[model samples]
Target: MPLDTGQVDTGQVDIGQVDIGPLDTGPADLDLEEGNGVLNRDPLQSHASIGEALRAVRQDRGLTLDELAERTRVRRSYLEALEAMRLDALPSRPFTIGYIRAYALALGLDPEAAVERFKADEPVLDEPLRAPIGVPDERDPRVAAFIAGAVVIVVAIVLWNVAQRAMNASAPPPPKASEAQAWKLLAETRSGPVTLGPPLPAPVESTIPPLYETPGLAEAGPDGKGNDSAPANINDLSDAPLLDLTTLPATFTPKGKVYDSGNPQLGSLVTLQALNNAALIIRGTSGSVYFARQLAAGEAYKVPQLPGLTIDVSEPSDFQVFVAGQSKGVLPARQVLASKLAG
Candidate 1:
């Protein structure tokens, strides 16, 4: 058979000249198999642990733990535990999975696939289901009575004001006096002018002696010309006895004890005060959160007396910590401050 060089036959084709687009370098989906009512049970699909895979991706991206923590907002210690596969050291299975997903995505890895890998490593505990709460019926008799009472009160108030206005309008006006009658009343009240009297002389001085005068005591300096010496000591006075402080009261008063700052000798009464509106978190030694909320300026929190506690603040300079009534200054931002009380 003869073929034309410029035109290809409809029945014949050249595989070398066909354009199939670019090659697919991405990974392929896992092969699925049906066994024991399960699909896609492949052992080779995930050989490395979730932490191992995440650590590899993170290292390949050349990111440090601190950098990833800043990006993901996960604690560096948590990330370290995740990388080390210390599941017991983590918060919980669900929280750890969430952390894994966030950490994996931060490193440019498939979060869903990473979560699946983590599920396989740790048992996924199902959260207990809670029933929805029911609201009270608004058509109840008590509610209707309350509403009716309120409406009656309002209507009574309106009606009382209307009645008060009507009564004021129906009342008679006060009587007005005529010009002739007013002049007659003024002439009857008028009287003669008052007589003048002469003024009396100033008061005379008394001749009684001062009650406080003494025989030997120098008279008060007369116009600053009398004695200029100091007053006699009260100890020289024989008429009055001095206070016997030594025998009157011999009770011993206890002195207040001074406490050291952040010392273990003091009782566990810890308090935290905020200088600015800021968010903070307080956790126990077991890593369980005891308090997590935003506090306004001058707001304070008295922590329950616990064996140990760790505090984390979003703003370091905005917080003032008190350990056993002693000021510990502001906490370091995003840093954990830990303390323990004496046994």
Candidate 2:
């Protein structure tokens, strides 16, 4: 080998045979994670039920019931029902779907997919929806008849009152004093300058008698010495105030059923009118933040319907809530209040 270094040997070197696998140019058959469509395990399919799927997703995200409730404005009870697959406990189909859609979106899942899964789990009713009782249909003949009767009765009462007024006007003329006497009285009264009574002097405190002191009976003994008979203070027996609970104003509760205006876009429109300056945070049921700011006095904010439609304010007493043109009453400052709207 040392001798061959000086000269170039014209010889072909033998290379050993080797096998090569085909190049992996195509997409790799990689397995994805549970939520990432991985390993042929659809997170949706792996679960025994839709509720299980939802619960898994929620748990995987480390969301608690209270946390989700605060986030979504959906009640904690309702969330529990959803996780438990208590279909009967949820609201109507439309409302339930709304809740599910919002929840799915919050969990970063496909809302449509969640909805479809939920629909499969819950059975739709074949029977038509039942209307609420006591609400009369406007097309009912009885309603029209009642209205007509009321109008007729009101008209009759008005006509009777009018006839009585006409009769009284035609028949009445009181006996008059002589025109000369009337003129004389008017002339005498009108000719004089008006005179006002002298102003009364304010009472002196020393001159005022004691509450129990009688005009004639003195507290002094027969010898004109002071008698210890009178109490230091005479407490009025009649003036003794008795607490009357009945005098308190009756509690106010909104009357009549609330009919949905059928505005799906706005479940419940609430407006806040600040009576004094306040800081507040408004959140949807899903706990989505809608507003957070210091609102000045007399400022008004109309908030869209959100989950739970909740508000947390620094000074609740400084503001009032209005819904559908009705006052909900003053808010308790520094407290969180949820919407009291009917389902």
Candidate 3:
């Protein structure tokens, strides 16, 4: 459109109205798979009754309570309870079946027999424990005197063994003060070495031991393997062998019941002595100390880098402690370091 020069225009116009409603913008429309309405199930096997098992095995072998107890090291009272189906009378389940199975095996019965019996239904234990008859029960009041006498005998024997062991562990037989005084008087009277009864006779060929010898030079193939036919004439030397005393510890526990020095400590290092008059020392690894009781007499134990720490025992049946190759002292059933260890 053409506009004339110097023309001006001014005007205002109105707009139309609009309406708005609420809208759903939140997350939706999720389809979940429902689980099955019914679930699966299973059953367990019933355990064997303790009483039934004990009774069956005992009756099968015809063993009485006393005999069973002696064999299994279980008390007669416990075995009596197990047979009566009185599970509660026994201590714990582990202890109960353990003793029961041991008793069963002593009777040459099957272990499963015990398992079956352990799970069987049991009767209420309203009555006191009873022993199987015809065992000549030593616990009987009638034989109380005899049993007491027998026990005393056993105790005496045990004490005697302990006393003997104590004596052995002590120093070699010592001379009394009176004997020393007599020796002094005798020494004053003596001037020189006394002649032996008589000179020994020359050894006969039969009495002489034959010398050992090897044959002529062996042929070698440079591989270091020599022919046995000719083993090279090597001469043998004879002389008193030198002992490695440094390795022998002066303290030890002998292998005897007189005193079972406890086993070596676990994780402790130990040396296994060559049984024939041999001595060895080893550091305590955790396990070495647990087996110390297993060491025999004539064996030596030494601690590496610690000479004063040692144990020496002789007569595999007796316990003795020697320190620095000399006797420190003797310990009966238990040994403790009585004297101070030289630094």
Best-performing candidate as measured by TM-score: 2
Q: Poorest 10 consecutive residues of model 3 by lDDT? A: 38-47
Cα misplacement distance, residue 4 of candidate 3 (Å): 99
Model 3 segments beyond 4 Å from truth? 1-53, 120-343
Model 1 TM-score, all chains together: 0.25
Q: Which residue ranges in model 1 land beyond 4 Å of their true spot?
A: 1-47, 125-343
Please identify model 2 stretches exceeding 4 Å from their true place.
Answer: 1-40, 131-343
Per-prediction CA RMSD (Å): 35.3, 42.8, 46.1
Provide backbone clash counts, one per model. Answer: 0, 15, 39
lDDT of each candidate versus the true structure: 0.64, 0.65, 0.48
- Give the Cα RMSD of candidate 2: 42.8
lDDT, candidate 1, at 199: 83
Tens digits of lDDT, candidate 3, 144-189: 8888999999999999999999989895987567888989889987
Ranking by lDDT: 2, 1, 3
Worst 10 residues of 2 by lDDT: 232-241
